[model samples]
Structures are given as structure tokens and as C-alpha cells.
Target: MFNRRKFIKTGAASASLLLLDKQSFAEILPRQKTGKEQFPIVISTWDFGVYANKEAWKTLSKGGRALDAIEAGARVPEELDITNGTVGRTGTPDRDGHVTLDSCIMDEFGNCGSVAAMENIAHPISVARMVMERTPHVMLVGEGATQFAVEQGMKKEKLLTPKAEKAWKEWLKTAKYSPVMNVENGTNRPGGKYNHDTIGMLAIDAKGNISGGCTTSGMAFKMHGRVGDSPIIGAGLYVDNEVGGATSTGVGEEVIRNVGSFLVVELMRQGLSPEEACKEAVMRIIKKKPENAEKVQVGFLAINKKGEYGAYAIQKGFSYAVCNAEKQDLLISGKSYY
Candidate 1:
């Protein structure tokens, strides 16, 4: 009762079905998108980015430039006195109890500026923009950056808030300095939950121009004068109007070693989706230091010229905010490697 022809036909049909199933499964993965073009979209790292995106949308929805939108977005967290001790003036201080800030801004024309280890400035993002607009340099650091900020008419104030001071006092009791993974998103520390850290934002304007900005307080209780990737172009943030923009959060050292954000944007240029590109960037970090990847968290958020966006992280609890015409105040949990 063996019919070779019938058996072969059935086998072919089964194989076709299996292939179709595989394709279907792939389509449902987090990396897959419809590839539709979205204009005037803003995306930023962390749930706090929800507020930041809303601020950016004010300019973006009004047909403003991507550069302006991102600057406006980044300033929201810089002025907030949140508990995360991540962004802005109230951030957790360095080991010696100095609250230094780092920030960078990039425009659609490849012009960028940054300030690192700068103290006493409440809005470092604005200072960074001034550096891009007024200076011949790409970065300013330490006392020089503080002087520049003051020269530009920004006031110097004590950035350490009462809450931050309390936390620092508590941390000094233990004096244990270890980077905690996912500390930003509801991670319980000795004092309380650290809400978030490091806000990196990217926006696409109605004219299809792309711009990005990154601002951070650096790591909590870090060494004095330590400047993380946030203030380094092509490390914490990169934007190409013709390609896209990418930003990163978490451990800046890991991000800096791999030029994390630039790699994500470049991967998108090579025809990968934003999510796929972000995943590849994270994998590169893991491949370089698999052991460290397990201990610390690093996440990348990217958007393509088409306005399609995606994100990947080394650990869970990394999230981002997205705002567009269709969706506003949306918080998306990033896909993680772990």
C-alpha cells in the first residue's frame, strides 16, 4: 500500500506548511514592524520620558524643527527634582558628593555639542545647545564648561536637593559602590525606589529631519570627574538625517566601549529595522564582556528615517516613551537579551 508519488506530494505540502508557520512566527516577533513612515514622532528612554515626550510633542506637533523638539524634551527632566537622581541638577552626587552633569545635543546637519562633568548648571542641555551653536568646539568639560555656562548667562546654584543629600548620607554609611542593574525602574535601594536615570531622546520633524539629545547625572556615587558616554557623541547619542538617530541608557562605560548609539544608527543604515539594530548593538556589548553584561544593564533606543522606532536592553525593566499623532504618552517595555 505504498504509493511513492502520493507520499512525495504529501511531504511537499507539509514542508510548505512548516515554512509558512515559521514566517508567521517571525512576523509576530518584537523586531517586526509594518515599516510605515511616521512623521513628527518622538521617542525617549525611560518611563519618565513619557513627560519628556509630551513636552517634545508640543513643538513637533506644531511643525517645529526636530532640533528644537529634542532640546525642549530634554530640558523637562533636567529641571525636575525627581528621586531617580539621574537627570538634571538634583542628580545623585559623585563619591565626594559633587552633583556633576553631562549632556549632548545633535542636530540634523551633523552639528553636535556636549558638556561633561560640569557642575552648578541646572539645564546642561541648553548649555550643550549653546556649545553647538556658538562654539568652535564639540565638547567642554570641568571648570571650563561651568565657566562657559556662566558666561552664557546661566546661573550657578546648589544642585544638591535635600532628598539627594539624604540619600548620599545614607550611601556613605555603607560606602559600597556597585552598579545595580535596572536601578532606574523601581529598583529598591536603601532609601527608596530609584525611579529612572539618563534621558536620551530622538525626534523626527515634519520635514523628515532627525535630531537627538542625551542628558544624565552619570552614575550615582561615581568618582569625581568621571564623564560617561552621555556627553560623548557617537557613544550615548548619534543622529543622521539621512539614516536615523539612536540613544542609550544605563552603564555608560559599556556604551562607550562599543560606541553603542552610533552602532545602532549604522546598523539601521545597513537595512536592519530599528529594533533589530538595537538588539545587534546590545549583543556586541555582551560579546565583548559577557560577564559584565550580566551584572550591569545597558539599553538602546533607535528610530529610523521612516520614523519607525524600537529598543533593546541587556536586562528587563528598561522602557521608553513614544509620542506621535497616533499614539501619545505610550510607554513600551523594551525587549531584553536576558
Candidate 2:
């Protein structure tokens, strides 16, 4: 149904492997294999989170490093489920009931790549990997990305899932616009600055090497072609071997503006723990008042290379499903970190 080689060719290649500027990969290596070889890898998807922890845990357990495990794990949601609407085969439809998708991947070495406003292609994140490793560019979008996919022989297929179609059909019956918390309307009342178009994953390998990636079906009831932070480097996903890796879900725009993922990693680099960095990043966005407001809103999740992790949001409660190297495990860090 999909052109694996065509998809693979979309990426830059030098000597069999997609060349992702070895310099970036070099920054995270010397792959430290800990004595705890049998430990499990963790995967978390909170309240609005998607993807099963087993999807990724299995890959890591098989000796795949964080990046491979994360991508392999993420590909499951991108290919099978429809509820997530942000990653996988069935995605949330736009106001018109058409599905568009976006995705990104970042390696611990700081190499980042993405694709956005995509339609027809099932695995945009894999396409994004091609852009990062095959081409000199970090992103490709819309028809351009599709054309590239086609040129490389990637197949085009229907992206809408039955469940998402049902959702749009139902929403159409009500036509009620929910008053989402907007980041732009900081002074008066908060409104949603960005549509939620993201599902993210962060992984640390047994050696402590790290990687992160995000994918989305775009925002629910969004404009037909709107793209969000899920496909932006440093915005949707970020990783640093010296620090850690992070990815965000909910409201892509605020995440982009805050440079959410990178900010968390930087905080960790500055001595804040993984959880502390995540809390600070969310608070930074929430405390922002544009000369007249109450509270800003945003949400994010993070994991440092040390295997520590955390998540935070401006709302009351947020939880992400997680599968770590320890076994089938889940973590819901709760919303409001004291």
C-alpha cells in the first residue's frame, strides 16, 4: 500500500544510510550500554496523548536505539489507529471532513526535520526523516512534499478514518465552537493560539542515547490545509545528547512560539531536572500576560538522557501514557506540578 523505497529515497543518502549530517549523530554516541540490559523503555501518552507504549517498547527491547524505537513505535499510530487524529492511518478531519497530517523527528545529536500540511501520505514522519537525512533541507510541506513522495514512488491513499469521519459528521450536527484557551488573547480572555495537531514520543536507549519525534493528523475542525507545530524543528521536537530530548502535544502554535521542546532541554542543561524543566516551560507560557490578561495556556512532555521524565500543561490535569525500559509501565504526571 505504501512505497517503502520511494519513501526511503525521498531522504538524502550517502553510502546506504540516509545521511543526517553525522556531526549531529556524533554528538550523542559512544552508546553507553548500561548493565540493566533487560530494563524496558518508557512511552507516555496523557489525557489527549496517543500511541500505545508497547508499540515503541518492543523496538527498544530489540536493541533499537531511541530514535529507531521512537519512530517504529510512532509508525504504529500513524498506520493503524484513528482516534489520535494526530498520528497514523486515520486522522481527525478538518471542518470539511478532510484529513491532513504533519510530523517531525529529532536525533540526540541536534539534527531535526519535519513535514507539514500533508495529505494522502500515511507516514509523514518517515517522509520527514528522508528530508533530514537525504536532502540538505530540514523540512518539506504540502504539495511539494507529496510531489517528492510521488517522485520517489511513495503511494498516495485516503487518510480519513471512519471514526474521524463520524466525529466530523457529529460536530457538524452541533456546529458549536468550543471556547478553547487562546494564547493570543492573553489580556482579555485566553484563547487557543494553535490548533492541536500533534502526538509526540521521546526515548532514551539502554546506552542513555536519546531521540524524540512527533506526528499529528492536524487539528480537529481546523481549516482544510492548516499545519501546526508538529512539523517544525525545535518547535515540535528537540534533542540534545548533553541534555535530553522532548516533544509536545496540544496547541502547536504556542509550542512553536515558546520553542517548547528546546526550552525544556535547555532548562535541563541549566541544572533543572527533566520534570522541573517541563514545569517551567509550561509556566513560562501560562504566566505570559499581554498587557491585560489572566493566564496563558500550553502543554508539553520531556525526557532527559538520564531516563528522568516529566509533563505539564496549563489545564487542571494532563497525563501521558508511558512505556519505559522497566516493562509495561505508564505515567500520568498529573497537571499542576507543586
Candidate 3:
């Protein structure tokens, strides 16, 4: 909306104003780099991330690769839990009592691997690593994924624990798919935050390399063979050594639709801080379904190349864990639309 007649009347003054406006506009352009981040950091998607961060820190503290730290951390919830196994062995199963798992791993080199709808494995996160290191494929699914896990000498174990099975059975009595609110909080009740979560971990090594891992049992009581966003790269988790890392929790379908994690990193690449990047990603989802934005929950955790991090959620129940040399903080992210 340039006004040529007004500008001509103003003459020299108008020219100086135009030059100043251009200079100000140039200052607002997105920066390509945010500078160096602190080394050896781990962040994850829930209270469980406190434990995951511990595992990730062990490796990072010793100069281990970011990928190793992330894989080790993501496997913790699976190896130690029997009740409400959200990720790894003993996870909640599909509607038909099938305990399928999904996981993905990504390294700083852009190399990645994944498994989807896999069954009977206790450590889908480890199996996913094996896929990344031992196979030529970027992803494996169903029986094929299981076969690979066994081939890697990973034992097939019943992933459905007594507690998880009990929950599933009780859920079947009603078969209601209602997702509850307050997901950004610390409550672990039925249909709470735990019901729609993944052990999604990200790490930055001492050398500044970044990696991420995400593992889940799919949605609680989802239809058999359902594969959620957890095992899908750029959806559940994404890592870029040059940009940052991001992971998602809550509704997987929404994450997949917007490629949530990837969006966060891309925003970071454009000079947004990790916190603002997460907020922008959440806005993308809200813009997609403004009418239903408050009805479901989705949260994103992001860490920039400089080790700075932040998270945001659609509701108030989204919490995460962060660890560095200072300490581990289990913090609830900022709330949104809901």
C-alpha cells in the first residue's frame, strides 16, 4: 500500500523514513543460527523423563554419542515398569489384547530407523537401535520387525503385564475411547496423561551432536495393528544437529497430521528459541482444528542446538524432564487454548 503522491510531497524526509523502515525490517528477519548450545544435555516428555535423563546423562557425561544416550534413556521405562507400560515391554495392548510396540531412533548424521506395530518385545527402543545399526532399512513393521528383533538376539517376551492386562480388560468392558483432560499435569489416572504418552528422549553429546528416540505402545485400546506417531520420524521425534530436537506427547494422530516434532525444529532453525518453536508448533495444530483444539491434548518438548530447551501444551497437564550437570527438573509446560 505505497502512497507515491504522499511520499513525493514529503521528499527528503520521506526518503529517510523509507530507509529507516527498510533497516528496521531487515533487523526482524529470522536468523540462521542461534549460536552454540551447552554440551551433554538430555530432555524427555514426562515425569519418566527424569529417569530417562539420568540414563542419557550417564553416557553424555562420559563423552558418549547422543544416539547412545537417547536409546539408553528411552529403554528405562520399558525395562523397569510392569504397570502402565507406555513404552517398551509390558505396555498396554491393542483392543484385541495384542501388545504391539512402536519406536524410532535418529542420529545426528540424519541416519534413522524405526519399528511399528511390533509385538511381544520388551525393548522396542533397543530393537529400533538394532534396526538403525544392523539393517539397511529405515523402518520395519509387524512380523518383520519382530523377526529382526529376534535375529538381533533380543528375546521375545510378553509385553502385557498383569496390571496392563487388567487395565485393558476393564477398558474393554466399556470400550469407550474418551480421552481425558489435565494431560499436562502429573496425574497418572485412567485416561490421564499416561494413557497417551511415549518415552520420547533427546540428547546432545559433549561434541554438540544431537539425537532422539521415541517409543510407545500405541494408544491404549486402539484398534489392532494401529501404529501411532511414536515410530514415525518427523512426527513423534526429530533431531537435527544444526537446528535442534523435538518430541511429542498426547494425541499421535494430531502430531502426525502436523508433523509436530519436525515443525518445532524447523521453527528453531529460523531463529526461534526452543520454547517459542514449541509454541508455534502447537499453534499449527490449533489452526488446523480450532474448534476441537481444546478437546484433545498435545504437547511438544524442544531443545535447541545450544542446549536451551522449552515445552508447551494444548492443556495444563503436560509435563517434562530436563537434566544437565546442574540438576533434573520435572516441569509442567505452559498451557494453551484449553
Model number with the top lDDT: 1
Tens digit of lDDT per residue, candidate 1, span 234-297?
9999999899999999989999999999999999999999999999999898888875666778
Residue 285's lDDT in candidate 1: 87
Of the two candidates 1 and 3, the one with more favorable lDDT, higher being better, is 1
Deviation from native of the Cα of residue 2 in model 1, angstroms: 47
User: Which pairs of residues collide in model 1?
Assistant: none
Model 3, 122-214: lDDT tens digits are 888888888888989889999999999998898988777767777777888788876554332323432232365687888888898999999
Which tens-of-lDDT digit does each residue in 33-58 have in candidate 2?
22332333554444223234566777
CA RMSD of all predictions: 12.0, 13.4, 14.2
lDDT for model 3 comes to 0.75
TM-score for predicted model 3 compared with the true structure = 0.85
True lDDT of residue 225, candidate 3: 86
**Span of 10 residues, lowest total lDDT, candidate 2:** 6-15
Model 1 spans with C-alpha error above 4 angstroms: 1-34, 187-196
Which whole-number lDDT from 0 to 100 does residue 10 have in model 1? Answer: 9
Off by over 4 Å in 2: 1-40, 47-51, 170-176, 179-197, 290-297
What order do you get sorting by lDDT, best first?
A: 1, 3, 2
The candidate 1 region of ten consecutive residues with least summed lDDT is: 7-16
